[model samples]
Target: MPRKERERGAHQREPKGRKQRKAPSEGKERLPEDKPEANQLKTEQEKEVKLKSTVVDIDSVREKEESLALLEAAEQEDGLKNKNLGVFEWLLMVFALALVLLFFPFSIWFCVKVVREHERAVIFRLGHRLQGKPKGPGLLFYLPFLDVCHKVDIRLRMLKVPLHTVVTKDLARPELSVVCYYQIENVALCSAALSSLTSVLQSVVQAAVRDVLAQHSFSHILLHRRRIGEKIKAGVDSVACRWGIRMERADIDELFLPVELQQTLATEAEAKRQQQIRVSSCNGFQ
Candidate 1:
């Protein structure tokens, strides 16, 4: 072999051995540096992740607290409103109960009556007259089913006497009817004295007319009908005052004689008229 080739072969063999040892040492040194850098990078990433997690946790806790506070306030407001409503309802119920207690007995046990303007009420307790004369023409209260009320009219009324035959002083018979006008003066006295005032007035007036007609002659009665009516009115007024009634007036409405008497009277009147005519004719001739 040549000397230079041999030296070249030896140098190559020496490099292979040295390179294996130095390469391992250098790899070990570089691996330590790379491990530190990688570890630092991983730690920084974990810290950033923890910071993000802490921030999320804090926000969630704050939201929960705020919701709880709002709900509590709403519940407190509702409770207060409910308490106020309860108090108002209690007051209304109490007022209604008081009203019922105050007026209930009166409504159930008493009665109300109204009297018109043209009427008067007479009250009686157990068939006995009350102290007052008559009730007013307005509202009145009484015990239910215990007091009795009788209403009386105070307006004017008319009474007509039926036609009846009567004998006069001159022995003449006549049928007559009379009309009487009267009004109530005191309701209580009238109701107590007479049950039906109109009927009594008719009977009294009929008797009065018959008596007055019988006291005078037929001719005198015919002429003085007004005076007879006045006399009858005066007689009735004196007696009616005790019954709480006032006699306004009395008038003769009908006067009828027998048919035979009427015919005889008419014949006599004709004869007198004929005689008067004859006398007038004689005077004219003279």
Candidate 2:
């Protein structure tokens, strides 16, 4: 072939079986620097995506940790509250029991009594309907539950028995008063005589006084009151002997007329005195 034809044929028909690599033409040449720049841009974009994912993961972990800490804190707070409640219950129970234990001893003295010396304590037993024998001069224990004990003075007792005006046999009213003395004799009879002892004593005294006064006039009760007292004492002795009481004295205190009666007496005395003076003057004139 001619030389130009031979060059054209070589350019068009690549070497057989082995691919021919052609050098780029000058007008369409690729720059090696641009390839490296593109690779760096792609690597930078990948790094940015990875950084965003890491940030998300870190925030999630922090949130989880915070929630767990809060839950644990709540659990701890609940446990502390329960512990405080248990301590308060224990303290309250202990205090209540201590108060009960401390108060038991004082009740002994408040509900019981011991018999004393130089006195007789009469025991009133439960369900017996009768007073028990009088206990004297010993360290005797009283019943704390079933019996009550009372101190009975063995000494003589003096009481005032008053005398008063009554409708006399002479139809006159006289004022009077009296003093009396009495003592206990038969303890059993006295205790059984009446449930109300003071009332019983008053009844006996009044009864004696009424019986004795029935026999006397008003002047006898006021002037000769000594005899009246002796008679009253005798009457009282008869009654009190059975009631466990002994009569020692019956004495008068004061005797006076009522106001209306006193005025009448005074006016009558004045009129009688005036008449006597007039009679004396007339006799002297004659």
Best by lDDT: 1
**Cα deviation in Å at residue 105, candidate 1?**
8.8
Model 2 misplacement above 4 A: 1-118, 129-133, 161-165, 258-264, 275-286
- How many times do residue backbones clash in model 2? 1
Colliding residue pairs in candidate 1: none
In model 1, what lDDT does residue 278 have? 100
Tens digit of lDDT per residue, candidate 1, span 1-109?
5899999999999989999989999999999999999999999999999998777675677567656644654453333231223565456546655655578876544
Candidates' TM-scores? 0.56, 0.52
Q: What is the clash tally of candidate 1? A: 0
Instruction: Report the lDDT tens digits of candidate 2 across residue range 85-113.
Output: 35654565466456545775863454445
